[model samples]
Target: MSDTAQAAPPDAGAPPRTGHWKLIGPGIVAAATGVGAGDLVATLIAGSRFGYALLWAAVVGCIVKIALAEGSARYHLATGSTILDGWRSLGRWTSWYFGIYILIWGFVYGATAMSATALPLAALFPFLPLWAWAMIAGLVSAAFVALNRYEVFETVMKLLIGVMFVIVVAVAIMVLPNVGAALRGLIPTVPAGSAIYTLGLIGGVGGTITMAAYGYWVNAKGWRSPAWMGIMRLDNRVAYAVTGIFVVAMLIIGAELLYTAQIALTEGDRGLLDLREVLADRFGPTVATIFLVGFFATAMSSILGVWQGVSLLFADFVRNIRGGTESREELTTSPAFRFYLFWLTIPPMALLAFGRPFGLVVVYGALGAFFMPFLAITLIWLLNSSRVPKEWRNGWLSNTLLGGAALLFIVLSIAEIARLITG
Candidate 1:
């Protein structure tokens, strides 16, 4: 990959003028993959503690992510190169950072994702132990990704998104959210002792390393050039808007049911199980069961998305580092892709039995903490450079948002590292 901008695809013509709605696959995948159990828990905890005070943070979080996702996809569309290619052009150091981060991140994340996915299932059906359910979920997700291509994967993700939207939003409405209070929450007031919760709600909504994979997914969706920029922006915005809805819905549940009752949930994924128990007690087992089903959909979607999206990333990383010339479309079936999918599925099962090693957890947290900042900083570097065509160079608005995101993630990373050290 050269620093000079690659020529646009021959098909690059006038940007699509109609049917923008049809160009929505990658954003859906990005959203499904980005929002997992932990995000839901974070927003729920914020609402439980502070009522509707941090609603502004959730909306801001969505906007921050929209900026990040759009910037990443824009680089790919404008440069006729993958995000990894842009990183390669930056220097060898980017590769070193990513290489170390992806390996450690995937190992810990595999066990974490499997456990989160298995939580709802184990709660719903206790015949199988949590570990057994986790292993089954991991294996099934691996198989699903292994057997399907991007089109099939996108179809399943869309279906899961529909399920999540219907169920979670339905439950929030059932709680009869105070319209006036939720409206007032949009004012951005932070109550005493709620600063960290406010930051978490603002920073945690639908954010993940999979965000960097948005470009690969954009390619996989057959939108390979600058002509698709309009639809891509539309797709990115719509996806995060849906993500905002999910975050708000979870916050509503927490404020109405738990905050009002003065109830506290156990920390981590188990908090969701606690919510199910509360739902069962208050609304009956039927609604609780439905929520459990929705939880499975949320967790499973993350599994499928990571297994597919991040694998595409790992595959690209390998190709870039090895100087391989395989096209982006071929990455899904590449040996490197299969190896990463396997890495994400099998080896992490050991952690399920023995538990995450303290050292590994420290490294994972440190690396994961800085990833978003790294992404923000790099996009600002890449998009403003000679690599991207001048016509597609980021405007002042993009620069400001990306700058804010960098500062925000840097703050969050420092906070995360402090927490790990103290613990």
Candidate 2:
């Protein structure tokens, strides 16, 4: 064969292929982080309350994620800047909002992630008290982030994802309902007693502040052009689809296994731990063990991901604010980056000592509810304007989806605020 024939076809007369799978990075990491413990609990509650009637919300969540992830990736590909840079182009106000948001969000989320990880460890091995296990969880995640390079971080996360994938998806398959009912979930009708949780599940489906980190992941993967956009979309789609499946599986467990069982799982992550005992009772110890392992994988991955990913964001934020002419590469590797990483891991340990403040949890949720809408609205403005090249700007479809996400997020945010205030 000629050299040209052997080299594989080029994309739009650009460089020849090395392969596609090698390009998958940010989408996987962002999607993984977005589907954290809180998200899982949302799906579980939806399942327990309404069975598969609200499954459409989970599907809607997947769509919202794709829109948000694509918007972030689009900014990077079009403008050759981080979303932070894009925000800077808009004005200092954008940067200020993110700065305040990250500071408050990180403090509260650190404690929440640590506690979620600790709950399972305390369950799996009662040798340690919950607070001690929580502290250990924080330290272990800190070590994982501090010790590993990006490639190693990605590998470990993929492994954790695999554990979650096999167990949760397998359980879903094992308890497969009639195909008709599952397919009917796609029609988008709200079931009785499902208005709030349905909205919650839709909002929860793979949504998180980590969605902003998708652009950075793309930068890490070396996908930096309009040419790679198709593959980028595919990557986001596949990642979030897998995320949706895991969520739906948890919902199925709630619906099929726990709904009518007369057991009231506790609030927050303690509820998930309680659900494990319910699993043990209903499906035997092996299934319960599977639940525990899956829970730990979900929690630990979220911790490691937030520890590394948000630290990168924080480093960039600080560098941008400091304005000392640092490059992205240097910003990520700088002392400042490591400092924020340490900050994310350590100071929250104070919360572990005193027990988490209920006020902070409500603030976290209330503040968190606004993030998706914030990201969505910002991307619509950034990616659509002169900040990016015309070739890489969001097409009509991307805009429509993002606009829909913004609207959905607004409604969800109001609902969340009402719940927080009322509770």
Candidate 3:
């Protein structure tokens, strides 16, 4: 029991780890990326159209995301592999499917993201054309990604997240009405014309292809072991916890303010610009301007995160498929990574020149429809197998939650496809 008998010291080669607040990396990025322009528009459209009847859908969406994101993080911490590599171990076809999915997703998403970011900018600075503002957003996102390290990127995103919750939620609080009806939304019933929006909200809550990037952020932050699982859970919870509050605030604004006024919010990101008009009428131009600023922050944060995070995933995909697994140094320093990063930034700007990229836009929505189910199904496979150590794999409860997410997203996707096909 002597000090000398206190045993050999911990291994010098062991990895360093983060604790508590510093464990905040991936969760913040994932949350910021998830609550983009599409989410805002969807919630506002629901509010303007259906009042508070679909409020439960937004809350449910947030919960589903928490489960899905935690699964991604668990897979990373348990197996020490990116989801791309995890998919590859399942089969070569898995990699090919992801490659095609991401390629199409990114091309369309870049244009959509740029346009969303530009709406606020154009509103604020009318001198610049919308396309000009769009280019600036794309370039600004590219510059930030090119120059900043992961820590810097995360810090900036955290700040934008702070601004969004403060301004947007504060506005919602200022606008809440009919506490009785707002509470009734918790009953989980869908009104007429609300079924599609309800499913979209449920499936869209804080999700995107970037959810898979949770692991890279974990690795970037050095959160590398099973002991860190509790911390990972807390991080994911707090992230979507903030996201849930944000969506609820949007719903309140929609139901209390927009429904009462009988104002219709347009579909897509322009709906946020539309909200500016509604806010101006109710609360004055100052509040309207504040909302625009928040909208800009939301759009910009997602663009920057995708510019950096997804490009990393793309780079890894290339590395895995081409049999360069041993080249970690090259993977980080490779031309493939830079190429995808450029691809994410550049081509979509051309859409600004020839009007909006309608085809890209359509594909973005379709890709989005299937993404949550894809993530849920893949996480179920990855975490419930020998790929992850038995001790760290999903428990029955986790599997059940993920399975529910899969079903929910599948239903949502079917509805979306029907809308597209019929339209």
Candidate 4:
């Protein structure tokens, strides 16, 4: 890429950029961050229990995410503002809400992300306890993000994603998914008692609060004007295309192996551990070992993803809240960014030793539910308002999809709340 291709706006107040792709980075980072072991477990559980019954739901999730990402990317390209800037323009309340939410979200997610990354390693080695592995994982992720720029960050992310893709796809092929059943799954039907699982498959399709970080990634990639729109779109599409394939492959493994065998795995990352045993039984120790490595890749990718992306988010939040101009370089090196990165990596390790406090888990779960609808409703509001330029605004199709996403998230959020309440 030339200096011209990778340049930021000549003036901060310049018009929309008319640029195209010489490189694709942020989209891969976003997709990898969005799908952790939790996502894989959810898809696998859905597949094993439901047997491709929610394939369309997973597809719907990919579509919803694409819409959210595009709207976010467009806002940055059109306005040269971070999502925080856009939100701040909406009201001071947006800043307060995000500032509070990011603090709470990062603290809780830090522990979970670290633990997820540690699980496969613990299982593989069996020498160190899970908590010890978790501590090491957090330290490694923090040190890297604290030192690297977006270029190195992106390179490492793509490499992790490549490893993830190969291992999962190989597992899927080994399973030999039922072609007719999978095709039927594409038609979209809810079997008895599977409504919530179906909704989860659809709504959980590779998303998180990190969706807002799409613009940060875009800016980090040096795409600031609408001119880079073509490259942005291409990058975004490729990201989700890869995400959808990974989800489907996990589903195939679930349906073919677990469903047929009438065995149900435990939930969360431990579920993948159970999967390793099954793979060892069916294939061999070597294949299961490879699968476990892929599992680590998925979990660690998420840890690094949030380590880089959300830290950027926090740094930007500090810049805006302080009423100071924030250059990308300044933001990357800013104390606030490194502080959050340290916060994400170091403090959470305590949770591994002491165990996550019960009171903390409840608060974490509630706030987690709060984010998806928050992102969806906020996007619909931001893109449709005079805030965005007419040319870059949402079309009817985009609005319809976003509107549907808001509704879907609303429904799902309600379900999560109810589950929390009743249980």
lDDT tens per residue, model 1, 383-411: 99999999999899999999999999999
Off by over 4 Å in 3: 1-19, 326-332, 356-365
What TM-score would every model get versus the actual structure?
Answer: 0.96, 0.92, 0.92, 0.94
Which residue segments of model 1 deviate by more than 4 Å?
1-16
Q: Write candidate 2's Cα lDDT for 40-88 as tens digits.
A: 7777777777767777788888888888888888887767678888777
lDDT digits (tens) for residues 269-331 of candidate 4: 789999999999999999999999999999988999999889888999999889988686567
Candidate order, lDDT descending: 1, 4, 3, 2
- The digit string of per-residue lDDT tens for model 3 on 1-423 reads 222321222212333354576556679888998789878888877887888888788888888888888888888778767778888998988887788888988877788789988999999989999988988888888777665566678889999988988998999888955679888987899898787788878887686788888876766665666667777788888998899889988888888888877888777788888888988988899999998889988998888888877887888899888877633223434667668767877997876677655575567668778877888998999888898998988888888889998998899888877777776
lDDT of 2 at 399: 90
Residue 225's C-alpha lDDT in candidate 4?
A: 85
lDDT of 4: 0.85
Select the stronger candidate by lDDT from 1 and 3: 1
Predicted structure with the largest TM-score when compared to the true one: 1
Candidate 4 deviant stretches above 4 angstroms: 1-22
Q: Against the hidden true structure, what lDDT does model 2 obtain?
A: 0.78
Q: Which stretches of candidate 2 lie over 4 Å from their true place?
A: 1-18, 260-263, 358-362
Which structure among the candidates has the greatest lDDT?
A: 1
Where is the poorest 10-residue window by lDDT in model 2? 1-10
